[model samples]
Target: MASVEKVGNIEPMPKIYPIGGGKGGVGKSFVAASLGALLARHGRTVALIDLDLGASNLHTFLGMPAPKDGLNRFLNKHAQTLDSTAAPTPVTNLFLISSSTCSMEIANLFYAQKIKLINAIKKLPFDYVLIDLGAGTNFNTLDFFLTSNKGVFVCTPEPTSIENTFRFIKAVYLRKIKQLIKRHDFDAQAKAAVLDTASNALTSRDIMDIVATYDPEKERFFKACIGRFQFKLILNQFRKNADAGLGKKIETVCNRHFYSPFEFLGGVAFDERVIDSIYAKKLYVKNYPATASTMELEQIAELLANGQPASSLLQPAL
Candidate 1:
């Protein structure tokens, strides 16, 4: 948890948004960069940390070369603090903590290092901290995403991407349930239910059943802790031919089945020019403001900034 000193009263912690999905090539980095830029444009201090580990490339999206000082320096103890590794981006009010400087073995961070990094991230002084996670549901990725309940999952409209996204969501949800059980010292039955022989075979309902039977108070506490999670989903590379209501439909399904609230923050229209913008080393939202994809991104950025749903703006674009 983030700790704050009191000047007169406790200061509000930065709103951390970990952008991740189960698969790569889903525009996770693009969305993170665009959202960071948009939020900074709104006069909020934003820090974009590339937690992509072995596959870091977020700096390119911001039209800047990789920075020499980044997470690697802090992780290696060369930097005293994680914030010390932060390098300013070309965008005003935006900072970048690239992982490009990390060694090849950096992806497999040790347990101690991971915990230290997580705690340091929480201490970063910024209005908004956006972490661009690498692909997959690895323990590290899932833990990073869970560092804040306000995770933004990005996926495309393709069946495979959507399937991977669902898998990612399940992994994250299960991880949180296990943490709660351990934290509150649930009975052996509850632990067994969660750690069945088969991998990820137990659902939230199954564990909750065991937990409720063991202790109703713990069950309620677990439910409340899970319920407090506010997850947001975004669809990328959306084409007109694809189902426009797909995001909302997924959101509905997740809400009905899971304990946490899931909000679909609309889709970014597919545009080939995004590739062109990338090749030219330019920020798409900055150079192509009038494009369909950019406009959609802007709307998503606004919704994130306001931290509320604008039903009219959230309606699927036809």
Candidate 2:
């Protein structure tokens, strides 16, 4: 279920996972950095692309000064390819494509430019590619999260964070359904049905009903395609007092509501030492390898590397 690209010759598909949540301060960057380091420690060459745009700070979490070259160079055409901007990290097999040096307006990418960048990302050569996306339901953020079927959403165990995360999920899921409709070349009426009508926002069931109304045969195809998306959820900043099963409950609810399956990939406990490591510019997992957060992250990393649940059938063949 891996995606393949042909750049000069056939290239293996790196398992691309875009980490995102609707709201900031949920530890998305930290999760990306930790997962990349853990995967690299286990011998996978990983590329961590910070797509946090204007507020990029993944470099700080990784304990490295911002790399001189990054997405800015690639987007500005100063660099030939996205791969050229990958800077080595302290970890042996991990690389980072920092967005810290990008201009203030970097987040507002033109549609064509956004597509070009997404295509370039698909062609990146690595065993795994983890994208740290900015927080929002903007087109850029949603599109980046859809870059791969294996998107990991992070959220704290709070009402606002969880609510925003759900919004993020719905936005991405809707965008993906629309993409599938376009990619599969659904009929004119089917396409028009999904178009926003001021009063009613389209839901997954609504889209499926429209497809079924247009072509019952295509409905099956559409459901099958949607089912292939395997999204994973992570509860960040978890505490002993919070519901221990909140992540699992959310996963069950999401799986029940959405067409795609959701997997609860455990939680990373809140630890003050994490802040200490960040202030000191050190990788938390490396500095506190025995902490509960580190252990849970390792488990999540292992699942990501070894699990074979599903992958998107609609991701453009780069």
Candidate 3:
């Protein structure tokens, strides 16, 4: 177990990656733990944060009991920084930040409180900060989801989950666009006017129309920002040959509708050992090392670490 002190400072600001899905029970927590574990196995210090404030279970997935301190304590000023709530898990080179117990108040954290929490997350010492965001598109989840250097959206082959995942992605994109516009000297009334139009499911052309009327340079900048934002998709619980096509379909949908091409990261087939390990309070990567699921997880981890193109791995299912 590596202590926080032993983990030297992450100079130059480590990259933060957030894993989020629009709906719950799609194995977001499981992916977070497995990826963190794999990264740790490679000698990189990893911090797994359960940002699902009310329903965090990353600790459970890692086979550890919930910590006495968590994000809630930090938010309520019961702890100074998120590092103060960090607990050493059984995995080497990995640290855990559990979510506080369910709290109605957590759902109502003010904007200032949320900013404080994010700043604390940035200050944590680690090479990689993987945030397992809470499910849904509420202000809390969306804010943290978009704050990372990269965002991974996990969804299964189910229709409802895919639709909600699309919604979540669109919401984040629109929110970022709105923020950029406001930051460009657009006052509250003007900003609300632009957002109202964009809220009606406006197209890129529509955005150009509104922005061209005000500042064409800002519009160009907005388009460039949209192009630069990074989003990756992972299809989980795949079981059949046809199930693999769902990933490309999602990518196509995102590119066609949202004007943003999504990198189809990879897929994980349905493996019984994943569930068995969860029930046993152990990570499959450690407990079922040779399983197919573990192999696929390793491939995904490599893709994330090296920024390798996943197109080669996106083969048709057998």
Q: What is the number of backbone collisions in each predicted candidate, taken in the order shown?
A: 0, 0, 0
Cα lDDT tens digits, model 1, 60-171, are: 9998998987988898899999888989988999999999989988899987888888877877899899999999989899888977879999999999999999889888
Roughly what TM-score does model 1 have, to 2 decimal places? Answer: 0.90
Candidate 3 residue runs with Cα over 4 Å from true position: 1-12, 101-104, 187-190, 195-209, 309-318
Q: List per-prediction Cα lDDT, in the order shown.
A: 0.86, 0.86, 0.77
Candidate 1 or 3, higher TM-score? 1
User: Candidate 2 lDDT, tens digit per residue, 227-299?
Assistant: 8778999999999999988998999999998889999988899999999999999999999997889888888
The model with the greater lDDT, 1 or 3, is 1
Which ten residues in a row are the worst by lDDT in model 1?
Answer: 1-10
lDDT of 3 by residue, 1-318 (tens): 112112234432556889998999898998999999998887998999888876777887898888777677777778876787778889998899887563756767788877777766767778888999878888788878866637899988888888889778867876666667655665444466677854777644555567777666566677776776578888888777646577887787777766555788888888888888888988778998866777788778878888873464445245
**What's the lDDT of the predicted structure labeled candidate 1?**
0.86
True-structure RMSD for candidate 2: 6.8
Q: Which stretches of candidate 2 lie over 4 Å from their true place?
A: 1-12, 196-200, 308-318
Sorted on TM-score, best first, the list reads 1, 2, 3
